[model samples]
Target: MPVRILDSRDHVLRRKTIPMVKILWKNQDVESATWELESVMRKAYPHLLLPIERLIPFSGFCW
Candidate 1:
């Protein structure tokens, strides 16, 4: 999967309020991708204060 993301301000549909974040990518299995992301987040920010719902991943570029 080719995953990508952008700040809400950089998105073409940034005007939308519901999604303050924009994750763009080519994903075959969304469920697996979601779990992978969650795992990574949990490891990276073990003491994160923000709720899981508020966390957003933004990847402007990928190799």
Candidate 2:
């Protein structure tokens, strides 16, 4: 899967209220990806809120 992340400041629809972390995943097989991400997030940032951006495909880069 290809993943891309953009900072809140770089997001197109920037919101001033909450800081955001964007996550994109490609070729993601449902269960494993979700669980893996959740596990990582739970351990890494236990308190901060994070929203995941689903299924973003690579447009201009090589794998």
Candidate 3:
């Protein structure tokens, strides 16, 4: 499960673009965070995306 969302960006493909987010997982270090598809996270872990502003307070991070 995700502990919080750290950042977000768009992935460009040959014919399309996919929204992605950097996810901080439970019991993991900040350096271990991974990028996941925004759509998938929204479906599986909606709560994590709901309070995005509150979750990412660090400078240089955007959601």
Candidate 4:
């Protein structure tokens, strides 16, 4: 079955987590980099991985 980013576990993790990824602390521009990467990924596999801003309940994530 195809797994959606809105999976329950992903939802909880994203909501509770702040930095999201531990390595984010290592880079000041990690946030911007993340957006860049996500943008490329979404374009490449738009159906497989949706945008993070689209939460599960309200709007969701994948790792």
Q: Best candidate, lDDT-wise?
A: 3
Q: Over the stretch 15-63, how does candidate 3's per-residue lDDT look in tens digits?
A: 9999999999999999999999999999999887776578667588477
Q: Model 3: runs farther than 4 Å from truth?
A: 51-63
lDDT of 4 at 1: 22
Q: How do the residues 1-63 of candidate 1 rate in per-residue lDDT, one tens digit apiece?
A: 335333333223556433233333365444433222433433554443255456866556667
Q: Assess each prediction's global lDDT (C-alpha) against the native.
A: 0.40, 0.40, 0.91, 0.36
Q: Rank the candidates by lDDT, best first.
A: 3, 2, 1, 4
Instruction: Locate the minimum summed-lDDT window of 10 residues in model 1.
Output: 4-13
lDDT, residue 42, candidate 4: 52
**TM-score for each candidate, following the candidate numbering:** 0.20, 0.22, 0.75, 0.24
TM-score of 3: 0.75
Model 1's alpha-carbon lDDT is 0.40
Q: Looking at candidate 4, what is the lDDT of residue 28?
A: 49
Give the clashing residue pairs of candidate 1, or none: none
Ranking by TM-score: 3, 4, 2, 1
RMSD of each: 12.1, 11.9, 6.6, 13.4
